[model samples]
Target: MLIDILTQRCNAQRLMIAEAYQSMYGRDLIGDLKEKLSDHFKDVMVGLMYSPPSYDAHELWHAMKGAGTEENCLIDILASRTNAEIFQMQEAYCLQYGSNLQEDIYSETSGHFRDTLMNLVQNIYKGKPVLILQGIREEGYTDPAMAAQDAMVLWEACQRKTGEHKTMLQMILCNKSYQQLWLVFQEFQNISGQDIVDAINECYDGYFQELLVAIVLCVRDKPAYFAYRLYSAIHDFGFHNKTVIRILIARSEIDLMNIRKRYKERYGKSLFHDIKNFASGHYEKALLAICAGDAEDY
Candidate 1:
């Protein structure tokens, strides 16, 4: 069956099969699958068909399309992705939707959240001398004095009593390298007697607060941030399986291993245990496969 084959085939093999299916039947494979399948099975199959960038763009579209914005989706895609990944998604968004990703995000979001998203989508990162495929850096802070200065700049940006200069905050968070910002965060805590995240929470409200917190957490510990996101996605009011699938699939090759370890350490249970509890059927099988294996105890 198509469903069975889809669940079993690798992405490349699936792409080939999709091509063959369309050639043979003169119908798009996803269209045919949608016609035949229902519910989550259909969802997973369709999700699998998209090349990664297209998949990222499609997720962004769905996140912004409805009445309410899915801020978690926005943060996950915008906050956690590498510079090259974001660049690819922006291109894919324009190509697929015939609109600029940045312009669409600006229209959908407002204030500091929008500011942060706009800067993040630009995919600008600095201080890397070597050419990397995805523009992810392996470098750390190079100047202590610069870090301290940036730290004070960040503290002043958020610590204002009358008005929080969110532009300055966004500039520091968006433009600074993660390694540089990590030092800045540590220095900010020393200077302000509060963590930058705590400062953001106290000074700001709504999606802006959430976006800044996500950025700070991402800089501090990426795997930990994702682990927490996965837990929240599954444990929230209604099951957020879409988030679970998106995060799992997107991070599978990148840092799922680290995420799994951090999730287990933080949540007192393995990600595999949680996934099994929350998901099932062929869809669950596909997720578990991407996860590589179950928990050590499981």
Candidate 2:
């Protein structure tokens, strides 16, 4: 009954049903599914039943649990989300695990990767301007002078003999509105004669480099950023299914069509083709459904 309803209902409705089941039965809906289902179906059902924050927290838990950390999972959840979304997940992580998400990430990882994740998860509750792409389109950029100043600050930060200024970089990335950052990036290119990604790559190393580059790409073009992420996740020695599922599910409604286009342009293969090749069975079917398109020829 749960599986049928879950497969048929939308995510919001399914969440409602899960809550109803828990309230009525006195057992967690996810716990029941774990008992009743097996394999990929179980994973899908359980994923579907979770509230987005709970699901993210659960993924973060598994990613950090054991001998090695799943850095990609951390990037996917921590890097891709908006500030408001991060705050909610932080709360959920604490509520679910009785521990701080930021501290947990720090304990599980080290150095630049830990710093990058910490920057993302902290200060998320601070009031920042809310602006989606469409909102930016409608409102346009407000401050060109500030953007130029920020661009200069970023250049100096990157140019320092030791390394980029951690606090300054974090402050700019965290505090600036997305729209403002978009302008800042353009100004950065104009002033530095190199894209931020190139500068980051030249100056930094390891996951910190990757994280900063991801932030720039996301600010410049989110769909393309995700497209690059999706490609790297699948085109590697072994496909990272967790990354694949997370990206597909997270962006299914937002800009996946654009992501698909970017993927084909960047990788010379369709995302659907990659999905069909890397995944199989119900998992494949579920991914293709969320993708909302058919496979394409290479």
Candidate 3:
């Protein structure tokens, strides 16, 4: 039914069905949406459905007040979506709601978390190999193969069980290109039957360890890993503050609820509860709104 509504060319038809479904059923049409769609079209529909009510100060204020903030939902919707859709959503969000989506997200989120999410939303390919090449060039290493080899070794350590090796891998993972890192990830997975994340958990410990593992897993199979990270950061890690902030802020616009469900299943805790406990300030509030899983944007 949700897909049927979304696939309609007429805006009135889509909105009418969506509003009617919400009114009569006393349930969000979005919750019913996942089962109705798949792939890029799902991405488009979900983004449109999960857009915040307004990107203006009033919406932010309401978000701050914990009434319909929809930050996590926005993040998941945006993150899983393609750059083109995000760009379109941003345009529509501003035109219809009278607010800039990027500015609003910037207002609601901060730090490296904000940076990473924004980078994604902007469709900045920071993860591309050219960025890695640039970094290598800055290091006075002209040979791509040499740089590639070093990157692979770091990735290898991230996969292997050696403490020193893992540490080295973590540094590279944190600093290197998502593009380069992604290649390295593919290489590592191919070389080892075990996933890199599994290797990280087996060999490393602590917040950094978890963060590194999260990044690895997110890069590997984003929806699945993010689902798990959202759960752990909120429920078990004492909100670990940073981790919750990092994952939520980074992925809120990306594929978080999928992460949320995975978190719920694996941890047996509500994703919202963890956010309520660990998150504080505007940031926390925004994330909580996101996890509630409303699909208003599409």
Candidate 4:
């Protein structure tokens, strides 16, 4: 049905696709998206599909093949999507694969990347609203003075040469709610007269710092940073494949439209043009579809 919808140029095709899927399958069209698409199209469709976690291990297996591991694609797909989508994807993955997506990723990837992605996937798939509420309450409820001291301790640990603090920071950034962390970030800035993210950057390096920066920049001003990422990945960084895939796959559904606008404003050229110049094959097609702002089509 999504393929049929995409074949036509009707303005109502997206709604038609949605209605057709819901009526026929008793499920959302995102599942169909997984079945019907590949490369950047799959990425964009997954973004717009928005079912309660409807992507399965088979679809994930296919997407993660070729030049990248399914593990990495799973992390990118799950991390970029909303929590509701993640939960639904987890359910679908477990049902179809006979194993949890989280468990599969844990087994497949290793080190801090694996750990950070697992923590994020777990939080999203947990189906617990109170976890977020509890995190928000943590510093305020358990003695403010003690909470402040503990936060300082955490910060100090982050500054140490050993990686334990870095691990803790990754866990915090990956697992904590952005809303909750926003408040904590504000408090940290108030105390130190500098952004907590800036402090983290000063203290860390390599992939650890990259992940930290991704989270902080995402939280601070996602669109602008994405614009910068797109620009840097294509022009400054000489079309780094992983970076290009990561930014495009991550933003296609949520903020590609904004990123496109920013790209035009920043570079005096459309992002679509730059993407075309730098990328090819199915990946380029998918990115073009997303930049065109018609992601609902499969």
Most accurate candidate by lDDT: 1
TM-score of each: 0.86, 0.83, 0.38, 0.63
Global local distance difference test of model 3: 0.52
Model 3 clash count equals: 27
TM-score of 4: 0.63
Candidate 1 lDDT over residue span 119-210, tens digit each? 78754346443244343333343567888998887787776733356787887787777888878888998999998888889888888788
Task: Name the candidate that leads on TM-score.
Answer: 1
Give the whole-model CA lDDT for all candidates, comma-separated. 0.79, 0.75, 0.52, 0.60
Model 3 deviation from native, Cα RMSD in Å: 12.6
Cα lDDT tens digits, model 3, 101-151, are: 667667776544454445544522445533221221122113445445755
Candidate ranking under lDDT, highest first, comes to: 1, 2, 4, 3
Better of 1 and 3 by TM-score: 1
Candidate 4 residue lDDT tens string, 218-286: 666678777877788789878866556556544555677788888788788888788779887766665
Off by over 4 Å in 2: 1-8, 20-27, 39-41, 124-142, 161-164, 294-298
Using lDDT as the measure, name the better of candidate 2 and candidate 3. 2
Residue pairs that clash (backbone atoms under 3 angstroms), model 1: none
What pairs collide in candidate 4? 52-88, 53-88, 53-89
> For residues 16-73, what per-residue lDDT tens digits would candidate 2 score against the true structure?
8777887898878888888987776567767877777787888898889857988877
